[model samples]
Target chain A: MVLLACGTAMAQLPIYNVGRAPTEAELHPSDGVVGSDGKELPPGRGTAKEGETIYAAKCAACHGKNGEGIYPWPRLVGGIGTLNTPIPVQTVGSYSPYATTIWDYIQRAMPPFPLEKNLTPDNIYALTALLLYWNGIIKEIDVMDKNSLPEVQMPNRHGFYPDPPQSTPNKDGTWQPYWNQAKPAAK
Target chain B: MNSKMSDRRGFLKGTAAMAGLAVGAIPFANGNALASVTPGEPNTSMGVTKLGVTPDEPNIQDLLYGGRSRYETTVRIPSVGWNGATGLRNLTPLQDSIGVITPSSYHYLVQHDMHITNIDPRQHTLMIYGMVDRPLVFTMEELKRLPSVSRIHFLECTGNSGLMHYKSMLHDQKLGRADLTVIQAMHGRVSTSEWTGVPLSLLLKGAGVQKQASWLVAEGADLCRHAKSFPLAKAMDDVIVAYGQNGEALRREQGYPLRLVVPGWQGVNNVKYVKRIKLVDKPYYLGRETSSYTNLKPNGKASWYESQVGPKSLITYPSDAHHLPERGLYEISGLAWSGRGAISRVEVSTDGGRTWKDAQLQQPVFRKAFTRFRLGWNWSGAETVIMSRCTNEYGDIQPTMLELAKLWGDQVTPHYTGEEIEHWWETAAIMEFLNNPILPWRVKPDGSVQDALYNTLYNTNGPSKNSYYSGGKI
Candidate 1:
């Protein structure tokens, strides 16, 4: 595909000059996704103690006072060793592999819609800290910010493994069964 | 061309002649079948007919947009939790569906913890940046001006039929009864569509993707900014930044102005209302991938990036909630597809898995799209099981429940010990994700068809000692 595109010569090809460079302001908000590396973490600081107050006012109605999770909302604490259990709870503390994920998820999607835009960077940090504290991963007074959030190692950090490579199709395009392949190994 | 037109005219003339015969048979001057019928009178042996007139012609307003007939009532079912915090999942009515194409309005939808984003096409722009030489942004109009391609494909939630797996497993152990849920409730998370869009490879080439970039994180514009990472190879293969569905503008619930069509992958990877595509060196490990879509195993390890769905098939007709109606010759029909490639063959088994026969595959089978299959079955009114299994071009045959359980490290036996039963239950719960086991439908003597888990001994052994039958008898 690349050779065909290059062979045609981009200028002579049917490539229309429709797209343009985005301005710095336009790119700022779209680039807010905080990866596992936490490179995009914004400058903000908050502690679990401060997050408690914010949780009561904003998140308690849906997430419950202690983050045990209301009817449909998910629980943010407990379920640390339930991955291998029959009834795995799969809460934020047990299953989430990265601390930055808590910050990323709560910052982007927490408290449901219509009110999701209300949280600031500090609020998200505090909420992330409070969830960690409730899960017994962090102290309530420990401040959570750009530098410390990445350092907070989750219990299930090493729990996941990348999926095994799927079997390739044969020369005639018939594929070997996926189940016959070896099981996925931990990375 | 002339011959084709004449053939069409002859077909129309034949249809008109048939209509004339029907009109002559009915005793009505205006050729209105229901005109002479009276309410509460059983004129026809079928049932009492109500006096009704043929509706008047529709006005311009009604003609502006076509609508389904009033008699047609199939609709998508939405799973809205107590607080709507668990996200909205609208399941298409697969039981009532016909053919491969899912109506745009009836397409299955999954809005991750967010409502349908009302995006104005004129204002929406898709940004491509990061690990690229040029960070380019294209407006809706600009995207439409680029080279485009349309393809028919199927999009299925990875969690489709997941809940049914849990329920069926639990019910088998506790009740020894087949699952009572309908096919729509179990397998409605999948739907097929004809998607039209600009290839992501074209857009990435336009932005000059860097050599080191192996993955790209596609993010949506919804409140959650739902994102997932995809291999650059798949992006170059067939990923489409779709702007149109089913020959028309996408429905609002289906990511209206724009969405990613990552063919053959799980639905979540096809980010909806897509706005950004950021090239990266490795997977971004987004929250959706890490915390949600990851599949847990019996060994306490979770598998991530398991995106493609294996080959699977379902018998839509003669499935649960359907009646055999005297049980003579019934056409058993269903749909089959695979994420790897086109379905090569589909087999139907009437007496459980003891015997199988090749089902006729409908013409015009598109790769990575639903393929309709049919077979004629002679139901003897006695209790029996019917099911369909499919093999894709990649030669992946849909596994039975026992075969899947064994793959998941749980062995199925004719008789289960106390400890064995507990182990089986745990495996079933953990194996909920990516469940594509063959589901058998039991046709009872009463003509009622019910969902039967293929692995369970519910059919041969009868209701076990722990049966949940309320009457204390089977």
Candidate 2:
């Protein structure tokens, strides 16, 4: 009987069309994501030196003086070649696959509290440069903008592989793990 | 590989048997001592000599405003610590809980902001914006008027058991350790609740989602403004814009007036105090997704794993913290759940993972909800290790620590440098972050059931280290 009800429910094409349409202005800043290819980066630029000062004032306390990080907090530098070790300390340069993610994260949630010290676009760019420089990925004086940040190559760039697909329970049907199936041979 | 109980005991004695060992640590008598005990009856009674004076206390139950007996104390949320001032985490007492549904007040708390956002229900509004035909805003009352749905689901942190593997590898031999039981340390981070809300799909459909939109950023109104991006696919599937929890308005700590209930996903994705959802074409690479919850691979790459609670199970009764005074007919019970689908089977093993028996699952085992399971065990009073493993209907069997290490250890390593991967394979922390492995409680010859890690306090820093949070204010 329940299956019959579900079958009937599935027969329907659409349900309640509830909310109203949104305008482009309402979605402006928070809507888009900056891709790894630097597609959606907002206009901004900053140098590692400026970011060094910002780091001392805002980030160093929780992230550690050299981005080595304190416990339960998180390290921003070092931990290179340590992933497979017993004490793998995942840091920015050593573990992150993309450099843009650093800028993206800092812009959204650095300090992570009070929600007061909202960083500007330039500050986010500068911190990204400083973090990359500290990790030996870039020179200290290098200025970062949308283009340069995207161009900055990370060591772990080629490291990430797709997750192993596993099945998920869904109402319509069982969702298969996308990564788990055998790939077809190329023609 | 080194599977003998005697071998582990000798190792624990050598390493952790300090001078001031606790007395009565071992139980007396074996399986033979319980031979005379009846299956359903016990002959022991307290010798209170007030038999005829009971009527003088309170006759005919005339008292008003009945209260719970003093002896019936509910489980407390064990405080771990504070993340600065605004963030705090408290683990639910999974060891003391019974049945599948965790009481509303007993639910585990994980907050990025310590200051609970208190919103006036009259003024609060939920805004749906971005790539939609019609951007819409709904008040709390307006949302309630929409078709509401209620469902029970489990919400678990991505790093729920992040310390189990690390604790396990502290020593070579695994002894029954009270401090390292999965229930006391890890399982407490997850809880199930019956959430009531309007389906996000209906809201999105009402807004007429644009063809190009692929992501939705759900933002909270908390001080931290913690936000995460969800796949458009998932947001339109089972996501709920929830306002009620356990049949009542949500608690202040649980987003008060509004939150998103993304069933079967990591707890973080279900943003609390949800005020706005902005649709987009790509993932926002938000702070939580990029820096906090993403997995670090051995090759040094990071991958995002936000959704789907994996298949896992743990025995709560006869667990590491609790004591078994006598060895007799004992009914062992625990919870099993999967993010993939309904749990198909649960198998219990009495001799480590060598032998297995099917356990009975309680009714109404809904997908993505907790399923209570039980099995009766007749202990022979011999030294043994008991554990359980769950299999979801999708044929996803819960992996043991060894199997998980072999599979995902490479992904967790910083770089595939020669020896670190091999070392990671040998350690226990590799599998600690996800679904914790089936924990084993060793039934000692003294008839006491204890965690396999009981004696090794020196190696794992004891049970206090079980808390992932520390009590520090920002």
DockQ in order: 0.29, 0.16
Model 1 is docked with a DockQ of 0.29
- lDDT at B144 for candidate 2? 90
What is candidate 2's CAPRI-style docking category based on DockQ?
A: incorrect
lDDT of 2 by residue, B1-474 (tens): 123332333222222212123322222233111112112222234333232111224424536634432223334333332222225666666766668888777788778745667889897878887787667777788789888999998888776765433333232114433233345455677888999999999888877789999878888777667688877888877999999998889988788899998887778888988888887777665567655576654544545643667677888766754555455667778888887678888888776555678899999798888889899888777888787778887767665543443445532222323344333322222333454445667778786566663233223433234211110000
Give the per-residue lDDT of model 2 (tens digit) for A119-169. 788888899999898889999889899789889888866554444212233
iRMSD for each candidate structure, in the order shown: 9.0, 11.4
TM-scores vs. true structure, each candidate: 0.81, 0.74
Give the B-chain TM-score of model 2. Answer: 0.75
TM-score of 1: 0.81
Report how far off residue B192 is in candidate 2 (Å).
0.8
lDDT against the true structure, per candidate, is 0.71, 0.64
lDDT of 1 by residue, B222-282 (tens): 8777888877888987899999999999888888799999888888899989998888877
Which whole-number lDDT from 0 to 100 does residue B132 have in model 2? 75
